[model samples]
Target: MPSPDRSSDAVTPFHLNVPEEELDDLRDRLSRTRWPERETVSGWKQGVPLDRARALVAYWEDGYDWRRCEAALNGIGQFTTTIDGLNLHFLHRRSPEPDALPIVITHGWPGSVVEFMKVIGPLTDPVAHGGKAEDAFHVVCPSLPGYGFSQRPKEGWPVPRIASAWIALMKRLGYARFVAQGGDWGSAVTTAIGASGDPAVAGIHLNMLVVRPTAEDLADATDQEKASLESLQRYMQDGNGYSQQQATRPQTLGYGLVDSPVGQAMWIYEKFREWSDCGGEPENALSRDEMLDDIMLYWLTGTGASSGRLYWESFRAFGSDKVMVPTGYSMFPKEIFRASRRWAERQYPNIIHWNELERGGHFAAFEQPELFVEEVRTAFRTLRTS
Candidate 1:
């Protein structure tokens, strides 16, 4: 059991026990899915393939086990706490090593605390995972507001506000000082945390960086920089429809997503195929169980609308502020927007570590857990002060 809530701003233990009725409702919904006709052309250019969607839903209804996912979450010690009037859910695992550094890992859209499940044990208990005691860390993985189990905000909650909430959350957990790490929107929140100039934030490490290059920075771009820019352009042209919808009119898109299980699954499954290191099929990068486990976070929470609202609230707000703390960046090859060190350094002046990895993509931790863990351990090894 988790420690009791100590004060008004107390942290409370949380458990997952979805009622059997909810599971039955999900099966019923999946059984009665109203899928559209097959795409005019073959392949994923049109979205999740019809046959693929049916196959996944078939497994989800019959073979997938929500209780197993619940057990895995409970095994890690889940907890919740009120911050600025919103209840936030998090996984808190303290290291056996007394002097381990404290770190907070945040997840982004189409993802939840599920992304960190594989990496948590290794981070908090390094010896058992083939690492020195010095490599251990006390890891905290928080569900973003409106994502997973966290309470959705009634009004707008931009990245800056989310960053403030994160800092407060760490302080509430008795971590006076800690490092922040993330990918996707997690990267945006971590950047804001570092930019807030909070002394409690020792440093930040990112697998995905949100950087907007200036005319000056772009004029003398190197070959790699040019390639990065081209990738961004391509994404803006072909891959930005979902972002545009989420940013401009999430409520309009939310009806279908919230009402249909297949709607929610394909919405996220498409990203898993597009953003992951998977060549064509998402299953190549993540197992069916892993993918559905994440999808369930959204489906169970009924947060399809709220989560999409994050983009509506802060899509254009990224790269508006510069992060000044000691920073580390791990650039995965297939990330939607890859920023070269030159582009990123212009925004993060004190960048201490920068590496271009051979594989992985937007969902770095979910796709390549071991590589992600190694990158995190190596990135923060130099930032630890105690």
Candidate 2:
């Protein structure tokens, strides 16, 4: 195994040091944004209303503090490395206990390294940081290949390729055996890591588990399963317009989104509302600034196009292989991942723990930090014993 890339020696520090001029430019552009008149549809029927988006934009332009969030992020140990010829950005914080297990946490699309921001201090320095030493971990949260600070891949890269790169990253960090955790696209990547059978990857914890629909399960499904299937069908129907567009014609859509912050926010906002169980208003569960923080990452980095390319890559690899690793699944009430335990077992016979949570939505880490952290901790505990 390669030695940890200690070329930097001490842990690296991070800062959200944007030029003052750039912030001024963003503010100017927001002020100059040309808006369209609203349609007659009520609620979210017509997507984000013009008035609502205007309110959000107003807050983003006047009230939000990017530096504050950046300072909070910089408080943690951040690092960057060239892996597979791409510049990779990650937050690497080690527990006080030298022997603590190393775990890599990956963030999904529309999510920067922001989701883990709330959990890092607690996970890495659990004792002085406020938790048990046993729950301590050396946490590494990487911005995906084509997202955030990480340099985008010239061409499309699939989950397996990304998983391989993560394995290489862990190896580079001097971790002979470590665990992986993620949700959404992060979940997909985590599954691929285990499925790759990398000996160094001790276990995998995923909030979004994907399994093939069995004939029997679909043929005579339970009322609950049927309800789930209907929900899935509806998502594929009403909610998957963006997915279809991304998978087929992301470049065509990218032209408009790249040029307009409002368009970009609408694209992400639609998913945040549709996929999450946010009780009528997405803003109720997620602060407007929090929403804009995520949206701005794509806008500033101009990653809206590359981030959408995951759908195209995923479509190519979907249903072609099965991941036979010791995997744990955390089922949130709002996600459309309604696979039965039997179905999941068939695909992943080494399934260790399958948790069904009563609260939280797709953004489990951000929405329910304590519960999500506990699930990951519990899953690793079981995996360690096995």
Candidate 3:
């Protein structure tokens, strides 16, 4: 791929530095990765199909340049701070305008602040690019706890705890009443942050919101609702195994993931490729570098295990009280599944807007930045003024 553009527009403005010894160690590990034999199966029907992962690993070792990726990231502005004992990392780009709205963005598992790289420019300097100043925001994108540059917590850090830390981070940055947006795991954190009702939070926007079936919907659901429910059921059957494990026995899995980079890559790559809008092959929707960049962030940071712990923390606290802040939901077409407006309304009483999009998936900001920015901008536009 062409050298990454080093414009101020880049959202992730930080480069990772693996110690000389660490790089050598990683290389040694890659060289020593054990190959696993597999029974013949039809396409990814039996999970990642072993051969594909081997090919990716071969390319990763022989072709991929970590230094180049590190430079690409460092080209943007970045910083780190201690929050609630965990060191938090973030990308902060101030808007050119004198009065830009402060908006904080969070990323989910398998994603770092890197997901917002495409939209940082537009969100921070809209007026300079023919967009209205009102659409501009001083974007604050944080690598969720135990992910990216952030240090992993020894104790469990659940969604509510994360949300609390984010609220505190914004306060430290002097954003008393900022807007918040997230996707996937981010959606959960942002929702909890909104629910905190910390006057500093103006509104919440999300690309992924899992609304549990309500008593009424379950009683008299339409065919579409039934289909949606089935989709959810199927997801739980096939997809939720990861969540169950993380919630219950994250430490057990973390031991293996933290040791092997290939193992860590496979664990996350499978989710990105499977849970995305990609047509079977992830390369169809995302470039190899793009996929690897995310994986590299987790691997280099050694955050695979710590990040997985969020699943356990959040799932344990899922059935608490509802979040009562002004909320907005962006309905992406191929996000594994989406909750209907009615379903979302049941959980978030203050939902002010529900947007249906023509594109995007679970990784909305990365997959469809324009759509992601528009939905977020529109959702919070009214709240910002009021």
lDDT of each: 0.90, 0.78, 0.79
Candidate 1, position 181, lDDT: 97
Q: Which parts of model 1 are misplaced by more than 4 Å?
A: 1-7
Residue 291, model 3: lDDT of 82
Candidate ranking under TM-score, highest first, comes to 1, 2, 3
Residue-wise lDDT of candidate 1 within 151-174, one digit each (tens)? Answer: 889988998999999999999889
Give the least accurate 10-residue stretch of model 3, judged by summed lDDT. Answer: 1-10
List TM-scores for all candidates, in order: 0.97, 0.93, 0.92
Best by lDDT: 1
The best candidate in terms of TM-score = 1
TM-score-better candidate, 1 vs 2:
1
- What is the Cα-based lDDT of residue 255 in candidate 1? 93
Can you write out model 3's per-residue Cα lDDT over 236-286, one digit (the tens) per residue? 888877888888888899888889999988887788777777877877667
Q: What root-mean-square deviation over C-alphas does model 2 reach?
A: 3.4
**Clash count, candidate 3:** 6
**On residues 1-386, what C-alpha lDDT tens digit does candidate 2 reach at each position?**
11224354332344556677877887888899998998688888888878888888898889988887667667786677776666677888777878678999988866778888878777877787657887778889988987876777897688888888889888878888899998878878888887787788788888877776788888988887788788888887777788788889977888878878878988898778776768868876678877777887788778888888888789656433466767788898988566677777876778888889898888888777888888887788755534
After superposition, candidate 3 runs with Cα above 4 Å error:
1-15, 128-130, 319-321
